[model samples]
Target chain A: AQTVTQSQPEMSVQEAETVTLSCTYDTSESDYYLFWYKQPPSRQMILVIRQEAYKQQNATENRFSVNFQKAAKSFSLKISDSQLGDAAMYFCAYMEGGTSYGKLTFGQGTILTVHP
Target chain B: EPEVTQTPSHQVTQMGQEVILRCVPISNHLYFYWYRQILGQKVEFLVSFYNNEISEKSEIFDDQFSVERPDGSNFTLKIRSTKLEDSAMYFCASRAFFGANVLTFGAGSRLTVL
Candidate 1:
């Protein structure tokens, strides 16, 4: 079974500071995709960033980015210039790139709190 | 700027009763999915559908759970007999054929089985 692990249960950052949320996964498949999703109190899950396993370059989307260490099987999300709106339950998810389409294995999630 | 939409933002049902959660995925999307998040737990994948057939399902999806695309526009999940453990925030998601990794999720339907 594939499993994603987010070690921190909760994290907090002052407004304008940067924070990194750690994630690691165990999978036999060589090719896959890693994702970071943010769920606000509204319960809507929004995509933050995504990284393809084969890519040596990490993925970055505006304020969000990922440090993907394929060797370590670690994919961590970094939120830069954090704003109050970034406060939410952040989840790290993994999806197979080849067959077994679209099923995402997710971590237990890290609740992010942004202080004003 | 299309997004997946789900109905009945919240539903409360008695144990052993039936419940149906409805979703309307973004038009033109070829893949659909259902996921659930129990409070204080990880979000779990329930099922995935494509081309009128199930593509994948998690262990959490079993005989008691069924999915259907009754019409071209609507996808629904039916729980044969609800259990208290079934209570969770159920999310419907859809993805474009090309970018399968990017799934657009609905606001979600919170199901509470008492």
Candidate 2:
């Protein structure tokens, strides 16, 4: 079974600054996917960014990016130019390749507070 | 952009009562999934449905829980007998295909079991 771990339960970043949320996972499979999801107080889970295990290059989407270290089994999310809207509970998730398909195992989550 | 939608944004039910959460996944998507997050907890995968049958399920999805795509657009998760522990936010998601692994999630349905 694959397990994703987000060590930080709470994090805070000043507006317009950068923040990084750590994530690590245990998986024996060579092929897999890592993801970061954001849940605002509104309770909607939104995909922040995703990284494919096979891709050595990290994934970046606007202010959201991932530092994916496959060898270390680490996939961390970096939010640059953070804004107040970025305040939310961030979750790290993992999905094993093959027949398991779309099933995801998620971490407990890191609550991010973007201070103005 | 297309997005998944879920009905009954909030549901309150008594313990031992049946509850059904409904979702309408993105059109043209082939894979559908259900996930739940307890208060202040991680989002846990419940079940995945594809090709009109269950592709995968987690330990949390016990005999008391079942999923059905009764029609083309509606996917439903039914709890035969709800328990207080069953209270959580249920989210429905869908992906265009498996290789991409990009899932679009709907605004969750908050279920409160009394």
Highest DockQ against the true fold, candidate? 2
Q: Global CA lDDT of candidate 2, please?
A: 0.93
| TM-score of candidate 1 on Cα atoms, chains taken together | 0.97
Best by TM-score: 2
Candidate 1 regions off by >4 Å?
none
What TM-score does each of the candidates earn? 0.97, 0.98
| Candidate 1 lDDT over residue span A59-84, tens digit each | 99998888999989999999999999
Docking class of 2: high
DockQ of candidate 2, scored on C-alphas against the true complex (2 decimals): 0.90
Cα lDDT tens digits for candidate 2, B1-114: 899999899999999999999999998899999999999889999999998999888899999999999999999999999999999999999999857698999999999999
Over A1-116, each residue of candidate 2 has an lDDT whose tens digit, in order, gives 88899999999999999999999999999989999999999989888888888898999999999999898999999999999999999999998887886788999999999999
Model 1 Cα lDDT, one tens digit per residue, B22-66: 999999999999999998888999999998999889889999999
Model 2, stretches more than 4 Å misplaced?
none
State, as a TM-score between 0 and 1, how close model 2 is to the true structure.
Answer: 0.98
